[model samples]
Target: MNQIVLTTLNARYIHAAFGLRYIFANLAELQAQTVVREFTIHETALNIAEKILAEQPKIVGISVYIWNVSEVTELVGVLKQISPELVIVLGGPEVSHPPDLPAVCELADYVVTGAGEKSFYDLCTQLLQRQTPLNRMIEGVSVPLPQLASPYQYYDAEDIQNRICYVEASRGCPFKCEFCLSALDKTAKPFELGAFLDEMDNLYQKGARNFKFIDRTFNLKVKTSVAILEFFLARMDDELYLHFEVIPDNLPDDLKEVLKRFPDNRLQFEIGVQTFDPEIQELISRRQDNQKTIENLRWLREHTGAHLHTDLIFGLPGDTLENFAESFDQLVALNPQEIQLGILKRLRGAPINRHTDEYQLRYNPVPPYNILSTRDISFSDMQRVNRFARYWDMIGNSGRFKITLPTILGDRPFERFLTLSDALFNASGSTWKIALKRLFELVYEVMVGTLLVDSEQSQTVLREDFLRSELKGRLAFEETKPLTKQKVGKGIANKRQKMHQ
Candidate 1:
């Protein structure tokens, strides 16, 4: 029986829990007695409890996050009722701070906060030896970069083959963007590069084709960034795919040169252009060179083969719907592969809370804690933006409406799209589960009837998009054409990849 179990509810099965593996790897002498169990939110609390109980764990450590916190809270409550003697421990960003803990924290027997690897292991050691700590909250000890063991070796054959192989060459972010939990970090610190690469090589040799780096500022150190890229270049196969989150403004010549060498769709950069307004940037202590960011985005699109996935957050303290729309329009013009439209959430202990009063920020008070309303944007407008984001995912970002999107968006991208988003929701009474064929019809109807576009133009363009989408069925505007098969595997890793598959 496993004496110590490290577990977490992943958002999806495809995501192997990277943090749980790190803690498991560092369990020291307790490694033999410990096991790592992962579950997803989709599973019922009773089912998760049954599997967890089967292990007969003495101390159960659960890694909580914003995505799975509510379900985890319910799971923890279930565990407490069934196994009162079980020592429940909670550790993760969700439970880490706010001296004011949530219901989950109160239910947990012990809580370890911040850089929890070493601290958790030590707690297990103490508990297993029949000596429990006096206080429930334990301050996590930060191990030096060189001293911390590489977590890559923990990935098994199944994980490497099926899930996103998450690897981090470093920890922390230098920027103090108030909305992000990473703003609490003092500075960015790199692992010993040689050691880190050695572990990556080990992973690569074992058939890990997909490597998604968890570094906050990957391109910050040009030398380090180039070395990692060069390592992948040495083992360049058509299957080798890498994902990095790079600082939008900091693409040096050395990094770009290496980046350009990679084949198209082989590299994906998640660029965070949270806001284009300088006032919001300053208000949030975000230091983005907006001019440089635009230049780099345009350059990446023009020069490199990298798939650019950019982000824009709607509800910052001072941001208005009009300015947010302007930002959306600006980025739409650049034409990234995907635009992750986000609503700002109040993360516990995040410095963004400083503006809660001034901005009249009201959050959902639930798991994600997404802003319900802000001083600048009304609740009804926020709901409209929410619908806009949802329908945009189905239509705009799906890349299925390439031919018709430009016409629908026209000169004012945000306003025009907002109009369409409103009409789609009003017509369909949903932003979800609309079949591809049905979506095409909805867009066509909205274009011709609501937006008052030319019937012939709408039908022609919508039918072209429909044909390109390669659906099986025919629409009213369609003439029959054979559909082309979609290809997906081994290279690109986005949430949208499933549709093509």
Candidate 2:
């Protein structure tokens, strides 16, 4: 039986909790007595409690985050009720801040704030030795790169085989973007490149093909970026996929040369262009050269085969709905593979709270404290934008509506999409539970019928887009047939022939 169990409810099963593994790996002499257990937030709190209790762990340490905080709170309460003697420990971004929410901390025996590896190890050592730990709140110290044990060695057979193994060569962010918790970090720290690469090489040899780097500023150093790219480039295969969150406008010529070498479907870059509005950027202390960012995006789309996933946040202190629309239209023009349209969230300890009174920023007082309304954007506007984000994901970002997307968006992509968004929401009264067929129908009806697009051309375009999707379900229109292999091939050929013409 494990004496210490490191557990957390991930948003999904595919996401292996890197933080928990770090704590597990650093247990040192206590490694044999420890185990790591992960569950999805979908699992009921009672169920998670039952499973943890079954292990009969002397201490249960949970890695908390904004996404799983609500479920974890419930699970913690249940665990305390079932085994009052159980030593409950909490760590991670959610609990690692000032003004600890009483709802979560009251039940916990201890809370470790910030870099948890050494702190967790010490706490476990003291508990196992029957020595009363001095404090309930432990401020974690950053362990030196060489001194800290690599979490990668703890990856099991199943993890390497199936899960998207997260590896980080660095931690922290240099930019002080007010909306983000990373702003509090003094500076970015890199692990020794040689040692970090050796760990990556080992992981690769063990059949871990999907590597998602969690570094905030992955492309900050060109040499380090190139080395990491070359390491994976030499070992490229059909199954190989590497994801990194890059500095949008910081693409040096050296970085560009290496980036172009990566094959299609192998590299995916997540660029956070939170806003293009200079006023909003200034307000949030977000330093972004909009021209450079746009140029980089266009070059990546034209020259490189990297799947670009760009981000845009809806609400910020100085942002108005009009300016946000302008930013949206700008992003849409770049035509990235995916546009992650997110509403601003007030994370714990984020300096965004400083603008609460000034901007009249109100947020939901719960996990994922999403901005309800700001001085510039009203509650109604927020709801409208929320619907727009959802619809944009379904129609625009899904990459399903290739030919018809421009037609649907017209000249003003944001305005057009917002119109459709409002229409769809008004008709259905719900953003979710929309089937593919119904969504297609809604788009056709709203864009073609109500908006008065050329009916014949719109129908043809919609039919081609629908067939291109290769959806298993029935089509929105009666004339469309099920996509057979032969039909799909013919449709693709016809589209290719038209493109050549």
**Candidate achieving the largest lDDT:** 1
Q: Runs in model 1 with CA error above 4 Å? A: 479-501
Write candidate 1's Cα lDDT for 115-153 as tens digits: 888999889989989996988999899998888766789
Model 1 vs. true fold: TM: 0.96
lDDT of 2: 0.86
Could you tell me every candidate's TM-score relative to the true structure? 0.96, 0.95
The whole-model lDDT of each prediction reads: 0.88, 0.86
Give each model's clash number. 0, 0
